[model samples]
Target: MAGDAYEVLLTSTARKDLDKRLRKSPAKKDKVAKAVKRMREFGPTYPSFNTHQEKRTSRADDPTYISYVEHNTHGAWRMYWKYAQDKIVVLYIGPHP
Candidate 1:
């Protein structure tokens, strides 16, 4: 069931990657913002988007599940995240790399 509204966070790595991408492609800022808004409004499992689980476990050291939000753009972008408790912590955001 949908619990209380979940909080979305970005890890340092994610923040760094996003910053770089935004700097290089200012046009992507709006898309990134929309993606984040969707995450907040619909949580990590939004049905409209195809989100996939990541094989690399978690960076938080706890039992974690990794996932991503795919974005269509000139260079395909993805928003990676880790789910735990009531938060979705973004781990990365950039062109598939």
Candidate 2:
């Protein structure tokens, strides 16, 4: 399941970030655990299947970006993916806030 189009890639730094936060506060740990569990149950579902355009000035001249709004049990998460060659690539995951 984790090997398909959706790959949960947590680097060492990201893992450290998660561990530090979870260790520092119990609330954060609970919230993150719940979010993770929700993710496991439901891969990712968008509130709307519609596509939206975004302007990313940080990327320089090529600032045009298209994104989708996905939701989970906790809240909504923005999914930046590219639909090419009949494959969907999930870029990242995090709370909307």
Candidate 3:
């Protein structure tokens, strides 16, 4: 749907985390990008992932209420994020933290 789209942004910590992680494993970049695209096109759900594939976080516990995305080859990598007014602010990257 037209209104469900969102733009994704990374926080400073998330940016640093991504850079560090990607530096070690550049191949995972495409998977990360796909997750971002899903977030943008679907606003966290339109890809209709199972709970294992995506979930929610909240500002009370974390900086997100909606979530990041995907499983990883090396480990459980993810993005914690929240959305408002067409923006998905990625609060963190890598692991469940």
Candidate 4:
């Protein structure tokens, strides 16, 4: 548990997508912000609080996975991330499709 904390960051594409969403809906923006904050504070372990899965890996070198978190007033939202050392790179975020 000592190394549970990780640095959370969004990919450039994810940042652009989030910016677009923030301009369209304030409520949705708030929910996403909260989720992002949780990710930073709790790191990869935060996903355990929601429904999550470790995606199948073809390469042992890659540990990419995804999680479904409850979005405020809406259905579950999906987020993809991969851990590298002490960092959690958030690759994507969007409504389940």
Candidate 5:
């Protein structure tokens, strides 16, 4: 994993969404935790996407173009990351809902 650059950055909105979901349902919270653990172990390799939405306006001006993969857990969570020179940079994690 040398030369690999990975980071997880969660937007405020996404954080709030996850918090809301976790507060609303205990089952969902467990599922979310499990999914995140899996992601940490395996990286963002699930819920592959052929196409992804353009970066949000808040992040549009950023030079890096972040790609996302959607994971279906209790509701749905998104992993925003980028790959460069065999390195995967995980930029965000949060609930899409």
Candidate 6:
């Protein structure tokens, strides 16, 4: 893995969200882990089925520019994030919003 490809950071809420999801379906850990790996290696252009940036109006009041990666093949699992320089901070990980 290229440590410098993208520095992956996870927010506390995102970590909790992933934990909750993992608790519900432990079998998905591999998929989630692979998704994170691909995301880090390829960033927002990870070739997922649907990847997009959230519009300001949809973000409520949060000022950080965020994007989403549709990681699930047949479900709504998504990875919400933002990129600046080489940082890729994950803001959320759960159902599509």
Number of the top TM-score candidate: 1
- Candidate 1 lDDT by residue in tens digits, 1-97: 2443668888988798789879998987887887788788777677745775555664445544433344455567777776656678887787766
lDDT of 4 by residue, 1-97 (tens): 2443556788899889867866766566666777767777775566444635555652557866676555443555667777777787887777664
- Residues 1-97 of candidate 6: C-alpha lDDT, one tens digit per residue: 5574677888899899899988997877776787788777766666562566577554554434444334435665677776655687888776665
lDDT of 5 at 57: 40
Instruction: Summarize candidate 5's per-residue lDDT along 1-97 as a digit string, tens digits.
Output: 2332343445576567667756766556665565555545555544543225445543544323333333454536555554445544444545553
lDDT for model 5 comes to 0.49
Question: Would you estimate the TM-scores of all the predictions?
Answer: 0.74, 0.41, 0.66, 0.69, 0.44, 0.72
RMSD of 5: 5.9
lDDT of 2 by residue, 1-97 (tens): 5544443344455466556645655455554554444433443342242345444432443332233334344654443433333444333334343
Best by lDDT: 1
- In model 3, the Cα lDDT at residue 85 comes to 58
Residue runs of model 1 more than 4 Å from their true location after superposition: 1-4, 56-74
Give the residue spans of candidate 5 off by over 4 A. 1-5, 46-97
Ranking by lDDT: 1, 6, 4, 3, 5, 2
The 10-residue segment with the lowest total lDDT in model 2: 61-70
Candidate 1: give the clashing pairs. none
Root-mean-square deviation (CA) per prediction: 4.2, 6.5, 4.5, 4.2, 5.9, 3.5
**Candidate 3 clash pair list:** 57-64, 57-65, 68-79
The Cα error of candidate 3 at residue 28, in Å, is 1.1
Question: How many clashes show up per model?
Answer: 0, 0, 3, 0, 2, 0
